[model samples]
Each structure stands twice: as structure tokens, then as C-alpha cells.
Target: MKTIALLVVLTVVAADIEFYKTANDNYDIKALIANATELQAFLDCFQDRAPCSELTASYKKNIPEAVVQACKKCNPSQKHMFRQFLEGVKKVVPKEYNEFRQKFDPENKYFDALEKELSKF
Candidate 1:
């Protein structure tokens, strides 16, 4: 029974990793949002802050530690997708992006940081 349980756990973990990889490869918006939300949650993981759950997906219960690493591996494609997504968001709902930008990073520091990282690709 222990061996069976271990196998089941391992399978679930493997499937999760595989799903992240596939999502990274495809630049799926849901996956991107999940990662972004997780990252934001981590950033605001402080004493007086509430979690920014609005940006997160319901199905993603926890943050994947390797999301950024996976993103880096597919930087070229992911960067393009990210830029396109941002542009689309601005076009479709200008106010929403502005509000999100202010809420997540008021000074635009995160955007600058991302720009630096994505430039390396």
C-alpha cells in the first residue's frame, strides 16, 4: 500500500511538472496568469498584506517554485507572448491593466526588472 501511494504521489508530481512545461511551451494565458499570480502572492507574503487572489486562477492551489526557471528556458517565446498579452490587455481593457499595474507595482519596478531579464533572451 505504501508503494502504491508513493507511486500515486510521484505520478501527480510528474503530471504537474509536465503540465507546467507544456503550458510554458505554449504560452497559455491561464498558466501565465497562474505563475504571475503566484509570484505576486509571494511578493506580498508579508505581515500586513492580504494576498492578491484576484489575479490568480482557481485551480492553481499553490505556487510552482520553478515557474520562473521554466519561463527563462522558453524566454524568447514567452517574452513575445507576454508582450502581446500586455498589448492586448491594454487594447481591450485599458483601465484594468492600469489598475493592475498600480496594485501590483506602482512604481513600475517589476516591469523594469522583467524587461531586464527578458532582454537577456
Candidate 2:
């Protein structure tokens, strides 16, 4: 039973890493705008009062309090995409890409570090 559970955990971790890579690979503004609807739906999962309240709660448990507080202002409404949301956070907090990733991109690897990623903009 323990072995099976370990395998399951590893599998989920691997899948998450792959997803993280794909998300970062398509992190351009144009791609974000093109997939606005889908991206909004994804962000809605983490916003307050959404269907994924439990998941949001889980994130609140893991990430820093400051990150959660900043997220309130960074909340991307129906008018935004993932990229726009990041830009908003950049405007408000200035260099919180890692904090933003903690909620949206928890895996944290597979892309540039926070400074390198932000420099591209």
C-alpha cells in the first residue's frame, strides 16, 4: 500500500512539473490574450468565492501571508488574462513574481527565476 501511494505521489509531481513547463512556455502576452477565456477560468479557480474554494484555501495554507494579501489586489477579473494579472501584481508589488508563482505556479522550476522572468518584460 505504501509503495502504491508513493508511486501515485511521484506521478502527480511529474505531471505538475510538465504542466509548469507548458504554462511558462506559453507565457507571452499574445498567448495570454489569445487564451483569455480559458485563462480567466483558471484564475477564477483561485479567487475568493469561486468553485475551487478548497483549493484556494490549500494555497493560503502553503504560501506566505504577504503573497495572499497581495493577491487580493492582483485578482484578475473577467477582463484579464494570466499575463495581465502578473503585470498588475508587478505594478502593485513590483517584484513578486515568485510570490505570484507560489499561488499560480507552485512548482517554481522549469522557467526563469523571478528576476530573469521579469526582465523579459
Candidate 3:
């Protein structure tokens, strides 16, 4: 009976686990950042100034939850990649970075907390 109860608890715990999609994890963020056109596409997509590809759309859809939750669902690699991406964007394209902040964090409620969380990884 104890063994059965343990199995049930383990199953429940496993079922509760959640994570963000990893399909785009392997994309070369550094290359994307270095390319002006590709970077602008991402910016336009996020800002709704242009249509988004399926991949970018997925990210755009999740940005709010990811920010508010401090990327709790993100895996370690994602955390590192995101940190790099954010830093790169801030440094390489300050104007677009601000636009992204305005779009995603309009009231300025979450960027600082998000930055704090990202810095952890």
C-alpha cells in the first residue's frame, strides 16, 4: 500500500511539471543579433509593425507570461540564451530595445524584475 501511494504521488508530481517550448532553442542568437534585417524582423514582429513567422509568434505569445513569471518555465539553456539575447539587443539596438520594453512592459511594471531574474543565470 505504501509503495502504491508513493507511485501515485510521483505520477502527480510528474504531471504537474511544465516548461516552455524548446523548438527554437538551437537558433543562433548571436548571428541573428548581428544581422540588421533579421534583428529588425524580430523587432517588427514583437512590436506588431510586421507579420511574425510561426517561431517569432510563439515567442511573442509567451513574452508576457515569461516576464511576469521571471522565466520560471525556462530551462537553464533558455535562461542563458535569453540573458545573452537581452544583453545583445540592449547593446546593439538601444532604440529597438526601448520599443520592445515599451511594447511588452508598457507600464514599466516588470522589466526590472525580469532583468533581476535573468541575471541569475
Highest lDDT: give the candidate number.
3
lDDT of 3 by residue, 1-121 (tens): 9999999999998678687885587678889899989988988998899999988886778787888788878777777777877888999999888988888888999888888888998
lDDT of 1 by residue, 8-68 (tens): 9999876664322333334465444446564345334421155544333321222222222
Q: Please identify which of the two predictions, 1 or 3, would achieve the higher lDDT against the true structure.
A: 3
lDDT for every model?
Answer: 0.46, 0.42, 0.84
In model 3, residue pairs whose N, Cα or C atoms come closer than 3 Å (at least 3 residues apart or on different chains), thus clashing, are none
TM-score-based ranking, best first?
3, 1, 2
Candidate 2: segments with Cα more than 4 A from true spot? 1-30, 52-85, 88-121
Model 1 alpha-carbon drift over 4 Å, by segment? 1-24, 27-74, 112-121
Number of clashes in model 1?
0
Q: Pick by TM-score: which candidate is best?
A: 3
Would you estimate the TM-scores of all the predictions?
Answer: 0.38, 0.26, 0.81
True-vs-predicted CA distance for residue 90, candidate 3, Å = 0.6
Q: Which stretches in model 3 have alpha-carbon errors above 4 Å? A: 1-15
**lDDT for predicted candidate 3 compared with the true structure:** 0.84
- How far in Å is the alpha carbon of 87 misplaced in model 1? 0.8
Better of 2 and 3 by lDDT: 3
Q: Order of candidates by lDDT, top first? A: 3, 1, 2
Candidate 2 steric clashes: 0
